[model samples]
Target: MQEAAHTGVSEKSTIAPRKVLRHSVRGQILDALRAALVDGELAPGEIYSGPALGERFGVSATPVREAMQQLALEGAVECLPNRGFRVLTRTPRALAELAEVRALLEVPVMLRLARTLPASVWDSLRPAAAATADAAVVGDLPGYADADRAFHRAVLSLAGNEQLLQVAEDLHRRSQWPLPGAPRVRRADLVADAAEHVALLEALVAGDLAVVESLVREHFAGAAV
Candidate 1:
């Protein structure tokens, strides 16, 4: 039998037990592969081999295969006959339609959360927003994408509606298609986005639902461009 390599554990071990670790490994592979596909790191129509992906992610083929199936189910990739998975191509019109759907779903959620949730609920969002701003400033597209998603998720989570939150998250995943092959980060866009976030924070603090809705719409519209 092959012996598993043992690494020294840290003093503060937040690592989950074996079963949880296996689940997390699968999730990590899924998310990483999805991000790569959406960000255009893996170009549309590009074929990917499970074994190669597993090697790249430093995991076994089983997890990579699982992740690919998940991506396929999400419409990010497709299983090809006698080949491997291929990234799905998205049209500009499709992306525009997706943006519209996201705006419709998310703006209302943000408004409701702003009106209902306490300021303390937004404490977690501040750091994520700040990180996004920093990433945008530095032209770190991958980091910015992660932080951007986190910021939106934080706001959606505060709404306390599980169905809405899931829908919003799905919309967000779909929206990532437009970003692939786009410029890393535009300074002017970042500045404008940061300013909008500040204004949003202020609106939340003041418990202004109307302003929050308007700002959310504006933010999503700006991102569409």
Candidate 2:
């Protein structure tokens, strides 16, 4: 078995409730693979076998292979010749380019939301930000990661453009994947990072576009996980 598919990894690090509920078995496998990629259980440049991943997830190899194919299509993993998939590695340059694109795409949208959206719209999204805070308080990286994305998604969804949201989400997921050779991020840092959401929310509520712009710009400047 490749070392990446170790069944003993903590339950939180693997796909659980949301993926299982919203996605097909193959979709769930694909999401798990993404989380594994982000959480560094599946290292860059490692070839992971479908059968081994099936054993870990308690699914058959067919679904695992299908899911892996999807990941390959997304360029998150590469389909090996007569084998399984190899996780792709990203350089600092690549990660920076992703962050740059996200800032270019998302930051302006967020600034516009802050300027044009009413307080009630931001009000409805407060719970998502709080959920991120809750996740951070407990030092839960996986939980924080999910909640953080939700909070941002809620903010972006207000633009009333699903296709834009979809594109932004793809970039977001790519940014979350682990950067090659970056140090393991500390849990305390995650807690600190989550705190910024509340601050950004406050700035939005206050209608301070300057602070909001700065916050949104800095928000995309996340350390590699």
lDDT per prediction? 0.69, 0.75
Give the count of colliding residue pairs in each prediction: 0, 0
Which pairs, if any, clash in model 1?
A: none
Measured by C-alpha RMSD in angstroms, how accurate is candidate 2? Answer: 4.7
lDDT of 1 at 208: 78
What TM-score would each prediction reach against the true structure? 0.78, 0.86
Query: Model 1 — which ten-residue stretch has the worst lDDT?
Result: 1-10
| Candidate 1 structure quality by residue, lDDT tens digits, 1-225 | 111122111112121212224557998777677666544566665666666566566678678788888888888888864356777888878888888998888876677667677877665467777877787777655566677777788777776789977787777777776444565446667667766776787778777777877888888887722
Determine the C-alpha RMSD for candidate 1 after optimal superposition of all C-alphas.
9.1
